[model samples]
Target: MASVGFRGDLSQAFRARIPILYVESYEEHRALAEIAAVARDPELVRTPRALLTWSPTSGLIQPDGTARRGAIDPEDALVAALRTEEPSVFVFCDLHGTLGPAVVRLLRDVAVAFRAGPVPRTLIILAPALHIPHDLEKEVSILDFPLPAETEIRALLDRMIDDNVATGRITVTLTPGDRERFAKAALGLTLHEAENAFARAMVDDAVLAPADLAVVHEEKRQAVRKSGLLEFVEPHTGLADVGGLENLKRWLLRRDGTWLDEAAAWGLPAPRGVLITGVPGCGKSLTAKAVAAGWGLPLLRLDMGRVFSGLVGSSEQNMRTAIRAAEATSPCVLWVDEIEKGLAASGSGSGSGDNTGTGARVFGTFLTWLQEKTRPVFVMATANDIARLPAELLRKGRFDEIFFVDLPTGPERTAIWTVHLNRRLSRPAVAGRLDLTPALLTELTKLTDGFSGAEIEQAVVSALYDAFAQRRPLEREDLVRAVTNTVPLSVTQAERITAIRSWAADRAVAATAPEDWDMGTGNGRAVEF
Candidate 1:
């Protein structure tokens, strides 16, 4: 780790002729302040006066007066300041966009003139976004200022809470645990944003609770929305909300505590993540959403299809930006749906001249980030087809575990039926159905063999439609008729489904039970296509 008060490092680097610095910092003002401090130190510079040229304003300023604002004739001012023959520093702010013919000439002239002289004056360029032209590559040095750490964010949150409470307008008092959790959640947020989030939470409720985190989570959503790279999805499913994944659920539950107190203290590294491969609508996506809610983490969806652009370098740039954003908001959940389609190099094999190499590169980047990232961004990737996935993805260490989401089992079907029916029964007409009971649900499960959670949902819709058409109450016959007409995925893809189960049985963790999975002897495996 870099020691505190490391301003000397930058000054030393400056002395080494490494010129332009590309810093990605949330603390832009802090960087500016540090530069000013270093400039004033006699030991750091040969002379007191310095030339600082910046944009939309005037050129260089002598060190005597407070830093001038809105400098004009930026290039000439820098030249004028450099002509003093004293060791000076020239600071250019946001000059990257304006670096054209005249600006280039001025910079080149300054560099040449300073080298000719013994004063050792250095030119420094500052920009929020980096745009490096090959002409000046060797002339520039880069520095990165990462987002504020959790400690800084915690301090900011506490101060904001204290200020609000001091005014007597906010009566909420935060518990120690609440304070820590809130700070952890705001890890990637800027000092200003951390404060704003806390203030917003206080304003929303006088008593602060973990539930108040929803307000903090909204800031994350807004940040992602502005980026145009990723989407923040509010997960409505919970552990119970997902049906027939008891084994997977147990695996998840064991680690649920890992995110909380014991894991860290026990020196248990955070669980990496999981990949679910199964038939579509078998609750692969649902499990992803439910995991986030179950673990009390924000859920972010990564859409690789949206990452590509017509412009040559845009796709890679988009992916880099999105991945950075995810890292910034760490200890969150990243859900990639139908990941096979996105990561498969063959996705763009139509030969339209789109570099299939981009897919491989992107997937490699993602894999590296997943394994090496120290932050707690748990990734959940779902796929319908294992064959389409690159072998590199299935290799160990990419994810903590890979589970196969086969069809829901008998008991799982009962749970699924109960959950959806209870939800539908919340409606007035639906609740009054004559045959809505657990016994009916058990029978329905048998009829729904090979039906996905999504398919089962459609069956309910079809049953409701049948009853609505007759202007009568829904009954078992209505459900039975709905089931009969709905040629389940089992019948259409029997061979394919069997192959998947057979392949995954030895290799992958079964999301549901494997018992009674055989086709004959009145035994049926619940699966989705």
Candidate 2:
């Protein structure tokens, strides 16, 4: 609200001097309507009459009812409207692209003439897009109209439902919870989108259940498609599906209720975020998705690569826009997968031709937002290597916790193996006949030692593929062959993996148990927080 007021002031300040000006949106129309309705001052009565700007092609016409062309001039209309004794507002609708130097000059003269008189008038330019010419940069004032709020959407839905019922249409049956979901899903959607989605929901289901949420999600998908950079990912894995990382799982559980419960009332600050830095394919990305599902919050994946652009200043603007969008739709999880690659590329001087200057600037801006942002956007950032991560990001307070996910432990391995095998057999738990006993779980875990969670899942998938081809159930030999044929991360990148575990031993929070979690020992040793 404060931001809206500040932006509104920009237009109001210009309006104080200029009777001919441009503003945006229906909000201005409603505001001016209220003002025009009640104000009775004679000086106010001298204000210009508001008019909507439209091209001659938009069926816009002159008062004389002739074809209005080549450019539908608002100058004569604005000047004549201001001649009245009644205070008025002249609106130029959708004239953003048509605004020119001649029109600007004419508006400027009208503003000067009105300022010299005792009477006041206002000319409003309404556009969804902002266009400021170089010459009118200082003169033009822009205001960003916010999308409809949750309350507004709810009211609109209620009214629409009521009207439909009154018209002998099917009655809308929406519970309070369903109503809340409808409002939440409509957050990023425009008013039209929300209306259409709600209408479609009624047409398809005749009732609004929280399950009818795909319509809302579709609206969000449409918005994301417009951005071009963001891709809405459908998460396939869950916490149980993720191998090992017991410590990380427990930590996430502690935060599950933090966003939705009594934590704030108890004076606990909102959980800031988590930083997962570890070896590749160790469930870093999987954990991010799992956390969102665990917490029952929307997941917004930030594509850092899309922030930089060929145009100057656009990168920073794009970053700000992305941040604002994420913040606006709060109580959500923000996943920045392999963030190190994107940030390092921007900051490594390779982008700026060995000049670290631009990279530093971008990094600084990001750091400030990370620290100062008050939004409840749980940033789940993953990095394969910390060598490139800036020290500033590692400082306390940026992330609520930093967890290092090393190779799976024996017990962690057993859990991972059970999860993968169970998933493969379509029996998540030990059920009738598909005998995956504790002994089989242990043997599989030990045999596939040093494998990441991803590798473990892949092994099970490969065995299942083999079974499918042969028209038989997977046997122990299939599992053994899969393990033997595959070289784990331990053997493939032994030196790098060892160094990472060593760095994480003292410097980071372990995602495994104590006593046996130390990766520096060449064997997975646990180290407690």
Best by lDDT: 1
Give the residue spans of candidate 2 off by over 4 A.
Answer: 1-15, 18-71, 74-87, 104-118, 157-181, 238-243, 257-270, 345-356, 426-440, 462-475, 512-529
Residue-level lDDT of model 1, residues 58-108, one tens digit each, is: 444546654454346665655565565666667677777777777776776
Q: Write the per-residue lDDT of candidate 2 for residues 1-529, one digit (tens) a residue.
A: 3224433453454446555445555444443443343233233333334323334244334334453444345555444544645344445666666667766676666666656756555555666666666766655555555666677778878887788778876556677766765776676556677888888877774665556666766666666656655656656666765555777887888777565335667877768899999888877998999887766566778887787776777777777777766765555678989888767754554543335355555666777888988767789999998887877888898888899987766666777787677766774332333468878877887898788878988998887677668767777777878888999888989988888878887778888667445344323434322
Query: What is the lDDT, from 0 to 100, of the residue 499 in candidate 2?
Result: 83
How far off is residue 467 in model 1, in Å? 3.6
Q: Give each prediction's root-mean-square deviation over alpha carbons.
A: 4.2, 5.5
What value does the lDDT take at residue 465 in candidate 1?
A: 91
Using alpha carbons, what is the TM-score of model 1?
0.87
Would you give me the overall lDDT of model 1? 0.72
